[model samples]
Target: MQINVNLNGTEQSHDVEPRLLLVHYIRDVAGETGTHWGCDTSNCGACVVWLDDVPVKSCTVLAVMADKHRVTTIEGLAVGGVLDPVQQGFMECHGLQCGFCTPGMMMTARWLLDHNPNPSELEIREALSGQLCRCTGYHNIVKSVQWAAAHPATVGAST
Candidate 1:
């Protein structure tokens, strides 16, 4: 099957098998490997990406399902060489240890902040419940999201 998608702000068309996962299409066809494929069962949020501005686990979504939709991978969070505030927050708060779950965590955080600019700590934890980070103990991840919330202007303006 041939599918067209707006990927990370770029329009792309590719021929893919009906069974191909969106994560595979993003990594192989779109040539963007930032959206990591992990825990194929969707238990790990490592493969999360924005589908038409909402976050979805790419491993659970087929490429054909994403046809004609907008997909934003980790690579799309930046603009003109400036990192999104969430990215900066992660760095400043030491939100990641292994880095495997960083992309999905950031994507989910971005979506949360987009809808709720001032999420409470409990709300942040609830929003991140779906994503598992074996490292960092999640304290810093919550802080990172808090930092991003505190500095919403940077990310909102860029996006």
Candidate 2:
């Protein structure tokens, strides 16, 4: 199958199998390894990515379904070398531990903040409920989202 997906802010064209999962297409075909492949059953949110601006678990979506659609992987969060607030939040608040689920968590976090700029702890928890992290127990993750909500995105010092 020939599919064209707008990845991040760029267009990606690839010839892939019809049954190829979007996650595989993003990682294997497009070479965007930031979107982790985890839990084949889609129980984990590690495969989450923005499909046409809405976050969906790529593990459950066929790559062909994403044809002509816009897909934003974790790599899309940053623009022009400045880290998205969610990405910076994770660092400032120590939101990640094993680093396996960080990408997806940040993806979802960015979505939540976009729709709801200032989410309360409970709302943040609810938003991230689908994502599973074996490390950090979500305490810092919630804090990370809060940090992002406070910081937002602006051009300034990086790293």
Best model number under lDDT = 1
Model 1, 5-79: lDDT tens per residue?
A: 999889999999999999999998889999988899999899999998989999999999999999998999988
Residue pair clashes in candidate 1: none
Count of clashes in candidate 2: 0
* Segments in model 1 whose C-alpha atoms lie over 4 Å from true places: 156-158
Candidate 2 lowest-lDDT run of ten: 150-159
Q: How accurate is candidate 2 locally (lDDT)?
A: 0.88
List lDDT for all candidates, in order: 0.91, 0.88
TM-scores of the candidates in the order shown? 0.96, 0.95
Report the error of model 2 at residue 98, Å.
1.1
Q: How many angstroms is residue 120 displaced in model 2 relative to the true structure, after the best TM-score fit?
A: 0.9
Q: Give the TM-score of candidate 1.
A: 0.96
Residue 51 accuracy (lDDT) in model 2: 94
* Cα distance off (Å), candidate 1, residue 19: 0.1
